[model samples]
Target: MNFLTKSYLAYSHGEKTVSPWVILKPLGWLGSVIVGTRRAFYDHGVYASEEPPLPVISVGNLTTGGTNKTPFVEFIAEQLSRWGLKPGIVSRGYGGTTSEPVVVLNGRGDRSVVGDEPLLLSSRLTDVPVAVSSDRMADVAALLDHDVDIAVADDAFQHRRMVRDVDIVLVDATCPFGNGTSLPNGILRELPGSLSRAHAVVISKSDQTSPEALRRLKERISHWVPQERIFYSRLADPLWERWDGERFVPVGKNMTAFSLTVFSAIGNPHSFRNTVLKSGAAILHEFEFKDHHHYDANDLQKIEDAARKSGGKAICCTEKDIFNLPRGYVPRVPLYVPRISALVEEPGRFWNVVVQALRPQIVVASNGYGEDAIGARLARKAAQRFPQAEVCAFPLVGSGIPYKKIGVRILPPLSKSPTGGIIKYHLRDLYQEIKAGLFRQISRQLSAWNQLRSSCRTVLCVGDAYLLCHTLWGQGKKALMVATAKTKFISGHWKLESFLYRKGCRKVWTRDEETAVELRQNGVAAVFEGNPIMDLSCD
Candidate 1:
């Protein structure tokens, strides 16, 4: 290892001895403040989160890098796919020239436009599509358009803006918590305290650690996440693709004793090196590039020189690095890649978490014209977005004539309001209507759903959100209340009668940014999704 690399690694693992790397400590403190402040902004509803159209699972880490994110990401995606879900990946595309989010894989496109990590995923996942861009929301939205059932974000532990159904955090078992500091000073991206928000914690590369090490890690992780939410995983036995004489062959065993030069451009090269050694390869030479480094002709030439210098028989690389290599540019010596599989320790339990998140089908309760329209639109689109799911809809007003026209399954309405909840315009009618036991009828219907709650998943309240009575009052499997029409059209915001109703909502998506912004200004976690009415048109 280089001097700086060694020093940084030592510092990251809690070494306090003063060194040149210590100069950056103050900067780390500054970064902590900024990161904390931004998170506080999200927590306080200053900046609201937008939920992806499909159910999303986020895979990330507390440390800045070297958590073996891709392998675990692959693990989660594959497991989800095995359960008959069409899962897609959304990545930041760390190293690439592209600005807009684009589909990297579907048997079309190359590395230059798609970025390396996305291309890596494309090659690994035969059943799923991979989209890459810095704009996560755009990429996710596009993925939903491709009929993706579930969305997985590669590294989004701190991405509060994109609300996820489940946050699957990967803690490197080798170094579960890094020096317990934030950035520059250490490897931590967020303080350990923040892990409390994670839905599950995964201990990656557990194969390299001792049982005692894993026990200690679990003890610490249990403080943040429940023991049931913790999972263990490791990279499985590797299939080495090597050039055997004239033709390239995949090396399964026995060839590991042969001397080879290893190279990689991933977050955790040390972990990669250790895995290579464990595979029984006699290390001849090693080249470590910065994470996500784009390889070139000169780099390949240098690797060849290293192989010749060490008298190595072959050059080995990671499966992730294969995409960046020039197409059809076969080298003189064998260019082999270790095709590793991400194997979860307990597959049944890990898959159960994903299946549970996918179970919550929407129950739209539209109380008015605009709301009924939006609800029907979303109901149809929901079916399209989650075709594997059995979606249920409940129009809370006007006989659900529009829903009937569109072949949507409508739940029993709560109560019929003659004034249609426009009490200001028809107060006398509203009074007479309420006096005739409208509240009682509504109570009876909410009770019916509450009883059969096992049959359905969420309570989707559309229209004037405040008008939603007992439907969102207490019956909470999962609930979403959306504002279909802009509040600007109806003057100021509604008084929010059941102010406590906001607490019951799993999520609240608004039709426009202005309305959502105002809602957040008043401390409501309302997400702005561009006109769901238009979004459903594609469905």
Candidate 2:
């Protein structure tokens, strides 16, 4: 819908609520079925999920608009940056017409191309990168650079494909939960019980509630979640800073005494109205456009006419609305903006919830080109599933260009084939290996294996059984064996190498069921799973 109609707003607010809610319940149920089906697609891996190169913390709420999702996203970015990490934002730019990903705020153009939230984020957050695209799953990675430590996905709780490491769901403290229905009938986009998908829950606007009410709110959320996962926050210190074309001047008693014209295009205009009244500003006239409204010459002229009619001396608005205001068209009366910041009582605890989930890294090690491709594929999967853990690669042979392309940390001692994969030149390559000191290369390979052993919590050996033997050097270490090159029926030389598989790596995945049965008969813990390399190949 282009706008929230009066009937829907009345229904959402629980005024004249019943008959309309009953009429709309079937549609809400339909919304629930669709949402559930999508969630099931991701859960069962029917539709694939993609994770960014780094961890992602999503800021979203069940209710449609009033939760202040944008401001909370800013709060997360600031907090993540404070923890000595470079953070960026990926927003599904709702109002912009562009389909391609655009960097709206990085010391360049304004909000018109990237939508209001991104432009607002860029303006408020200096030196941070913000990318806007319709398909956040496919485009979020472009927003992040090699230096970005983590990413914040704005309004992405329902975006199942763009898998996030930390899902932080915000609840408006007044209602605590939704009006017990899904979209159209009420405010919730997903079912209320879906809050279980969140790793942490923040009850926003908590300051508005009394101490006893706040305690009850947390307890209520705990009914669906553990108490430790719940946190509280509010929009504190609402202040107006008057912009006189150049600098910001503080709004004071004298400023409020003058009759004022208010203009806002935020999701919750009532909150802005309350903040304006709190500033003691006398409202001469008020104009609220749709959320994220793009203003033009006509909108500006209407504001001028309204101010003239109401005899208001100045025009006031929220900081978000300033992004969409027409360029070089300052009204006759000055425009003042109300600035509100997200406040949390325990920021440290909230950050801890996010970081703890990202701990303990995964490492993939392989022997050759085929193995390296398989290792790179598994590393990306691990990175997506375990957002807190760093997934790295230690290539035993070859240049490891494939791992590098996927953003895997390619460990050194870069090796290459003498004839670049021409088996006809085997004699020349054998001579090259001898000339380069094959014994020294072996020693270095052993050292690299030790480094992998020290760095990773779990080791995945992709290609050769020699790596499995070398990687199992230390006790009390976890490892998985992928027999990518092995067949069910093999020569004596292959069977001799198969003995190393019995050295007790975790479950081994073989290329086919018969290979798994043979490995098991030979006293190795093996199972038939499809090859990882096939998933990586374009063919």
Candidate 1, pairs of clashing residues:
none
Model 1 over residues 154-251: C-alpha lDDT tens digits? 89878777767777888998877667777878888888877776767889899899999899989988987789878998888787777433333666
- The digit string of per-residue lDDT tens for model 2 on 112-227 reads 67777787787778767887888775456676543567788898988876657678898877665446677766677887677776879998877666889888878777877678
CA-RMSD of model 2: 14.6
Clashes of 2: 1
Worst 10 residues of 2 by lDDT: 448-457
Candidate 2 TM-score, true structure as reference: 0.67
User: Which runs of model 2 end up more than 4 angstroms from their true locations?
Assistant: 1-4, 18-22, 176-178, 244-258, 360-539
- Would you estimate the TM-scores of all the predictions? 0.69, 0.67
